[model samples]
Target: MSQLQDNFGRRFHYLRMSVTDVCNFKCTYCLPDGYRPDGKPKFLDLNEIEHLVSAFSQVGTQKIRITGGEPSLRKDFTDIIRIVKDNDKINTIATTTNGYRLAKHAQEWYDAGLRRINISVDSLDPKMFYQITGENKFDDVMRGVDAALEAGFERVKINAVLLKGLNDKDLPRFLHWIKNTPIDLRFIELMETGLGHDYFKAHHLAGNDIKLQLEQAGWQFDTPAVDDGPAQNFSHQDYQGRIGLIMPYAKNFCASCNRLRVSAKGKLHLCLFTENGVDLRDLLQTPDQQAELIERLHGQLAQKKETHFLHDGITGVTQHLASIGG
Candidate 1:
């Protein structure tokens, strides 16, 4: 069992795999309207995805997060979760979804051994929700959240990407809803990628500012416990659950980053904002090639960039949160 490490000396232990790029909602920050592909790209077959996960597990991957344009959109998502959960080496199995279809699938996913779920919901207002996500089923998403809570998903995360002029006003409302629920509300700073660059000019609302607002609102939070990702978490005083803030653009957590992402096309991305990625799909066809691929992944880790230059001169290639994973 060889261990994989990145260029920054961070050991790889978590892998976020994107199953499909097809999604129903065309969010302004993710995929915009009129963004069309010339042709359908080849998606990894169920067997191939299982093989990749199994091989990665053997090489020291203990956590596997399934992501997508929306993973629930995949027909075999439940079985995919089961495959990772049944693997003895994988201790954590989770998925990130938009929650549009979670009401129907959350229980099935839980039965298949999914331990956690992260749902991307930008706003609670129906109109604002439609404006942000290009969908009008905000009530359905709320029901999905309720369903997840009932389905025994212990960690139900609500990921809200804070766009300065768009959803910034909705933060307090989001925090209020989460105060009574068991879900963990996570505020993500908008990054300069995908459709975000087209609409969002300033990625304002620093983590400290949010914290101050919560404090002034008579909500006190404990110092966040350390975690694998960049989310700085805090449990509100007298609140049942916690609130988290991921400041990727303002405060980069690249130094302690122990995660790696596999894009839908099978490229291993060392950093979210990295323009290049190492392809591993073809190499997984053979056992010998699989071992070599693992070694290469480990070697690539050492070269992981310390942080991303989102505002840099990279035109239209900045890391899109949805394309990579949230």
Candidate 2:
């Protein structure tokens, strides 16, 4: 099999595929106001997604992470999971959701072969959660998490974007909750986007600061898996759960790049902060297009830059994280 390798010798093994660009949560960082329709969104359909994933699987892709504004919002979400699960070449199938429908649909989703789930839970405090996400369904989200565990997901991950004055101080609360619960709590540093420039400057917290605190508390770094996300995981002997820190700003961060992202509309993003994405929708139309699709994907690697220039304040064309399933 021809592996997806860039000019820098970085081989891609994971694919982050977005199903839609619509989200319900009005998070202060992402969609502060709310998810406004950006000129009649035309996302990928079931047949398109199947062809795309199959082509990727043929190119040595091992894992597929389905993301979106909120992937579960799709009516055929379970069917989407089944689509990826049907691809025997793909060994790992995961999804990142807002937990809006997990309480009721987690079991159904798990039954469809979704083994790993990453749910966004910015704050453990109900009031702070509402303050950050502009929603009041904190309790319901927590119940959804409980439901996920009951539905047989061994480890559920919670994603929290570390914001300076908002939920930054809530680390202690999160630590306590994860002590007994088998959840991998990940704290991500906010990235500067076209729309969140002012907000990023005011609330962005360094992920390393949280790393320092975790290390001081005796949490040790765990060895990363071959197809793991960029998170640097840490584990404690006494706790049932673990902690992960996603530091996109850290030095040589892109040196270990192993995943590629494709937007809901079939545009391949070389990097999250790239100025433009390569259109792949045309090649994803039919099953017979698999060979051309794989060749197109392989040829795009030459356009992949060594690293993103985010530190230089160049956020590319990304106005909102929700737009590209960040």
Candidate 3:
């Protein structure tokens, strides 16, 4: 298989496919009361999706992460997994879920060749969790975590999106939960992903501050943890699990950016913050143009944004995270 390398020499090996733009929970950070889907009802059908993945795999993409507004909301979610599972080149099939619908489908998804799972849990406090997510489903997510572990899936990591005063007060609470399990806990810096720039700026907590706070609380910062993505990992002498910080704002990880995202609407997002990309859906719709489509994809990727402009003025694909497939 040919490796899809950009002009910057970064080889593309991972693909983030947003299967559906519909979600159940309306998280304030991602989806809110007024948020709406940007794509058609059936954006990318099963065959179109499989063909795109096949084209990408030929260009050295070994891992595919299925994302969404909430992927489980789609009835064909499991079918998409099964379709990708048949590919010998793609070694991993992962999904980032809110965990509301996971308890019921964890076992089924696991059986359908799902490998990795990252569940989003901001706070342990019921009211605080609801406030952040605008959904009173904390217990359901907890049950989903338990269900993932029980399904014989190991390394079930927890993703906590860190905010200034919203979820920062519960940092110790999150650390305590990490101490109780062997699963990894990751703290993601608030990204200015077109949700509400002002809100993001107000709650943008530097990764260094979070690390310092943990150190002051007696958590020792150890060596980094191993992972596929860009999260900086750490460990504590007293804790069994590991801690990770994804600082896309203060510290940009674009130098090593090797992944590309395809929104549910079928547009290729070369960079999370860049508006440049190709309309793969339209090209694929044309008959007998697979080779043309592949060449066009490479052309778009050759222009992957140098950086997301985290510390600078943010001007790019400023769409909400729900539509962008976080």
Candidate 4:
């Protein structure tokens, strides 16, 4: 099988597939006003997802991360997990969610073959979480985290976007919470998008600040797994959990690029901040189109840029992170 290699010699092995663009939460950084549908969205159905995953698997894709505005909102989410899990070529099946429905579906998802889970928990403080996510489901979300662990997931991670003067100071609180929790807490840098320029300017905090503090506290860097996301992970000898920092602004951050994204509508995004994506929906309509779909995927990689233009203040067509499952 031919690996998905770009002109820059980056071989892709991970696929982030968005099952839907609809999110129920109104996060201040992402969907501040909430998700507004655009004339009845026509998201990819089960058949298309099966064909899409099959074509990708043929190209040496080893991991598929099911993402969404909140992937758990989809009624067929478990079936989606089963679809990716059923692919013999796929070795890892994971999903990122907002944790709204995790408590209710954690066991069902794990039983369906999901092994890894990532939940968005922007704040440890309940009020602050509500302020950041614009939802009062903090307790519910926390319960879901525990449920994920109890459900026997291989790994469980929590994602928190570092916002200035907001959850930035909650590092100590998070550290204490993770001491015995055995969870991987990841702090993501606030990325500027087409619609969040002012918000980004006001709230963006450097993930390096947290990294520096972690290093000072004796947290040692940990080697990443073969298909791990861009997070620089660190572990402490005394703690059960780990911390990961995702600093997209850091130099050479894209040098290790090995992941590709597919939007709910079947557009293939070579980079998170690309100007636009190539539509694969036409080729995803039938299993017979798998060969052409794989070929188109390879053709698109040839045009993948060396790096995203986020540092240059060019966000491309991404109005917000939720639109394409950031």
lDDT of 3 by residue, 272-302 (tens): 7758556889765644666777788888877
Ranking of all candidate structures by their TM-score, best first: 4, 2, 3, 1
Residues 1-326, candidate 4: write the lDDT tens digits.
Answer: 68899999998999999999999999999999999999999899999999999999999899999999899888999999999989999999999999999999999999999999999999999999999988899999999999999999989999999999899889999999999999999999999999998999999999898889999999999998778899999999999999999999998999999999999999999988966889999998878898888889989999999998888888899998888889
**Model 2: residues with Cα > 4 Å off, grouped in runs:** none
Give lDDT: candidate 3, residue 249: 62
Model 4: runs farther than 4 Å from truth? none
* Cα RMSD (angstroms) for every candidate in the order listed: 2.3, 0.8, 2.4, 0.7
Residue 89, candidate 2: how far off, in angstroms?
A: 0.8
| Clash count, candidate 2 | 0
TM-score, cand. 3: 0.92
Ranking by lDDT: 4, 2, 3, 1
Q: Which stretches in model 1 have alpha-carbon errors above 4 Å?
A: 202-204, 215-227, 311-316
TM-score of each: 0.91, 0.99, 0.92, 0.99
Model 4, CA-based lDDT: 0.93
Per-candidate Cα lDDT values, in order, are 0.77, 0.92, 0.81, 0.93
